[model samples]
Target chain A: MSCIPQTDLTKNRIEEISSSLAEPAWLSKERRLAWEKYIATDVPDPKADEWRTINLNSLDLSKLKTTKLNPNLGSFETALPDGGKLPKEMSAALKQYKEIAGFIWQTEKGTQHVYLDPDLQKKGVILLPLSLAVNSHAGLAEKYLTKTRKFSHDNKFSLLTEALFNSGIFVYIPKSVEIEKPFLLGFDFVGNTCEEAVFSRLLLIAERNSKANIVNVLLSSNAKNINASPSLSLVSQLNELYVEAGAKLSYAELQDFGQHVFYNSRLNNYVHKDAHVDNLSVAIGAAQSKVDVATYLQEQGANSEVLGVVFGTANECFSYNTIQEHNAPDTQSDINFRVALKDQSKSMYQGIIRVDKKAQKTEAFQSNKNLLLSNGAKADSIPKLEILADDVKCSHGATVGPVDPEQLFYLMSRGLSQKEAEEFVVLGFFNKVLAQFPVPHTLEWLQGIIGETLCTQFQSQAELKAEAAVLVK
Target chain B: MTKTILTIKDLHVSVEDKEILKGVNLTINAGEIHALMGRNGSGKSTLSYTLMGHPRYKVTKGQILFHGKDLLVMPADERARLGMYLAFQYPVAIPGVSVSNFLRAAVKAKRGQDVPIKEFRAELKDNMTKLGIANEFLSRYVNDGFSGGEKKRLEILQMALLKPEMAVLDETDSGLDIDALKTVAEGINSLASSDNAVLLITHYQRLLNYITPQFVHVMHNGEVIKSGDSKLAHELEAKGYDWITQELVAQA
Candidate 1:
């Protein structure tokens, strides 16, 4: 391994990172090209509709470090340096999910724990760290990693992630192998004296006729560390999902970072003939977050559903851009995004449903609803529809307003205090989308986060366990 | 002697600076059912809203006493806790809140404690059976996509669960079919007792036929210009409220 000076983002630093990872020739060359593209791309025009609410100037890429602190790997039975003690949030999540097919935990240092069921491994399932996958399964890695370059080119942060991703995971399910349980992936960031930057890339491929569910969680250490001056962090994540013909995949992502973390994520789903993909994203943390999610129905009979829930409190800011693209005949897609803001929080939601000319018999629907809980809170919703085929059906709706006084009055008349009434309405606002979540653990986790954000009384771990037992019964 | 449950003395209310209830005076006693008859804009609904403490309906110069305590100073929720309930004419829909969950919360607030799940479920089941509501209605969102009769039934269901001492039925009989009206009227009758009173507001006398009132007051131009036994409602229903307005004009 060659040692390079950790300085600002530059061509030399990119080459050093590529060589240090000992990546294959093709990947190294691709990273160089992506670096070129990253430099050539311009910051979003401030006057543009999508960029008006987002301020990127505060993100000083040069001041953030991209070096991995720890390079060793551990297994589920024994995670190193901490004596097998997981972070509090991750430990809670682990206890919540009693029957998971696999688990992977990655911190700023490196992969700390990994576990896969022996049965799945016997069936030719491969779940490995990205750095190891490129060498052990180089052919598969090159194929999918190259395909991810075709999306989100206009996003400079996405290109930067492509060129300098230091940590990642690779998941592959062979043909006809159905995993009944979900795989849990956790990414944690710990703050130190310097402003650290994390670029995580995930490539998941569900082969033809295979099925799987994956839950990805992004969390950070304590807020006290994050609030320390000059100790901020920037997290840039890129996820590429490929649902082969007749395959099904359910992917849920929950982001709960600290107060000083700036988060940017881009997810692209490539769905093939007769394949179905359900994607749910819940964001309740982070100082500022910008997420781009898109699904491409590339073949006939393809279906995709996208759902998002965001609860912002304090001065947290969130922006979401979603697209549902139908490129073939008889394709269907739906998008529902909801956001609730309190205190001085702000949110922006922009969605588009695009149907190609040849995509006849396509049905697409998009809706966004925002609820503001205080005078200082604000939300902006913009929904667009582009249908090139006359035979296709497409519709979109958007609403942004404070809590309905009439609804509040109705609840109050039923005997709830003002605070309790508002909390009930806010939770109810998110209920429709939460009900569509594929995993029960994810739903419960999201509920906990929302309850904490609303300052509602939190149940103890024992109480939650008892509640789960009752639910099971 | 019957104890007084609600007393309104020289009650005047305004909505958006326009007087809606001009100097209304009325009294209701325990174990008594009072029917309030008026035209659409005669401030019958305003009086109900003012009693329940709706912020939009301001009590400009009025004194409302509930069980001998000042009612105007309390908020809507406090009034609810004080055993006051209003069956709205147009109950607002709360999406994503299941009927069971909302009812549980309301019951908890009214009783100042969480009802045991088993007991809550049993009571809900019993009430649903009585109201002709399906078992599936417990999980459905509150008033969302519910039929008019269903909304009215849910209102009465709330009354049953809360068991308010002073209940105001504001046009509860307006949108119900004959069968639904009978069911709701029966629900009201079952809940009324010697410890509670009912103030039934309606535009027609059809509901009184099912649930007879001990007293009926005809409100014309925000004032109770005529009061008598239930015969007063029958007279107004037959005479079309014209005779009362003409009598008031003649008296003026």
Candidate 2:
């Protein structure tokens, strides 16, 4: 395979990366283009309020290495607590991130494979691996390949991703094809492998009047070297989930990785006239994570909603930024993020709602609330609104505090312990956001997923024993 | 007597350091209904809150015995589990939590298990209907948007489900229109049984028109200065509270 780069802008390193698997000219060129874009983007600066809390300079990219997976990988399937199925809200595995369309990618050996739904391809949907997409579907892929992930646009890691981009999926939804289930994207970082670098990209473009739910999940299927570096997973995702006139798009991004893992995500969305875009995400499993989601309302009556539920535990650090841009008349945008932080964890939420002059009668609200479980835990919230339209209604609110003790006392006075009381109150806050919209079985599943962590805090063996009895029942 | 369910002796209570119930003494056996009537600041509500073990109501001195067990020694929830319930004049509103949901948690906390969902729902429906509360009320947050009458009815509904042996209804009839007042009275009347004791605290004599009490105690200046049967409510209503003030001052 001639996939290795010819130049030294992180090029020579490409052959060793590709020659390790053998040369493929088309694959090398795709990686080369991605590297160029990554190098082109600027390093995120502290001056940018959105990236202030994010420690971009602290990343050790020299550790991100990619190698082959073990020969015999075991199944990573296990029943979720209660043996109940996961929330079935998302559309099925996406064919939109396949190798058919011009897009390049990165993946570790023996794990973290991207599976595209074959049926979607038959519907004229192009789901291609990004690297392969460059040779086969270059036109569409080139437009957004490095717009967000390239170095010139961002920094060295962004450049590093462009230079050593490995695994990803590119999806193009043809006009008017509605996918029933979410297009599911799963990245399984294999355990104890020589793989260091993880540079991945996923492009999603939906045409007018089409609809689908996309769920992107990151998981460390194996603990493979817990110390592995370039252990960095720089995922530059450009989702032009353009909900054309009357179209709809629902997306969920869930990140869960091993300790000390560095994960960064960039999500972009554009909603057209009378279209709807919903981005629901949960960030729980990383040593450090930074997520930036931006939504643009391009035409009249377009709507965008971003709902996030995050829990930061132990020494974890989470940074979340959301931008709601109202470009047209009568557009609506709302971002509600509820987060809970425990132990010494830290959380930062910065949300901006901007309404342009043409966006008269625009309605936008941005709010973030945090529940600090421990005295050492800290949360920073900065919610702002920029309005250029006099007739628009834009408001932003941010609050960071521990759960109200009075509420806890109320629940406890009803027989819950101090810990159970806090859990109830924290979950109750998120329950407000949950009740605002129609979600799948997300509440029940996430409850089971999150309850275990909270259950350990019971001071009274009585409460724990009571919970146990219920569990047994 | 039918196993004294509640016994309060020299119960001294205070709020923000101001003594409210000064050395009060009271006793309620199982299967008894007693009314504590007094003017606005006569410590009737304070007595109810103190019994419920509200943290703010400082019990400067006193021992509250319930079912022959030490009441003040236990926490509020433990005290509740021991069969004591209080229907607040102003029920707390918890936003985002449904009325039925709050009831369900209270039920589980009282029962210590997940009651079969269907049975719980059916019981809630029956109780709400019995209290004349609309079914839509169950879906709203607990007392969040409830009118005065609805909050009172919901309190009785909870009292019905919780089935506490000794209940302290603190002016349950306050702020209610006649129709809403009737709804609450009817709910309390339904809970009237030989196994439980009801302490209906009030200032007006109208609520007595609906649910007749076995006895009425006229509380004044942190102490019940006068006691009588159901007829006392009528006598006080006819002469107004000033008559009691005259009698109290004369006694002093």
lDDT of each: 0.85, 0.70
Stretches off by above 4 angstroms in model 2 are: A1-59, A66-121, A126-139, A143-163, A193-197, A221-240, A456-473, B136-139
Predicted candidate 1 versus true structure: per-residue lDDT over A296-389, tens digit per residue: 9999999999999999877788889998899999999999999998778888898978889999999999999999887898899888788898
| DockQ score for model 1 | 0.70
Tell me the lDDT of model 2 at B108: 86
What candidate 1 gets wrong by more than 4 Å, as runs, is A1-6, A76-97, A228-231, A456-473
lDDT per residue (tens digit) for residues A119-194 in model 2: 6667888765555565567666665553443212353454565456555666778799887555555565554533
* Each prediction's TM-score versus the true structure: 0.93, 0.83
How far out, in Å, is residue B42 in model 1?
A: 1.1
Cα error, residue A68 of model 1, in Å, equals 0.9
Task: Give the chain B TM-score for each candidate.
Answer: 0.98, 0.96
lDDT for position B58 in model 2? 88
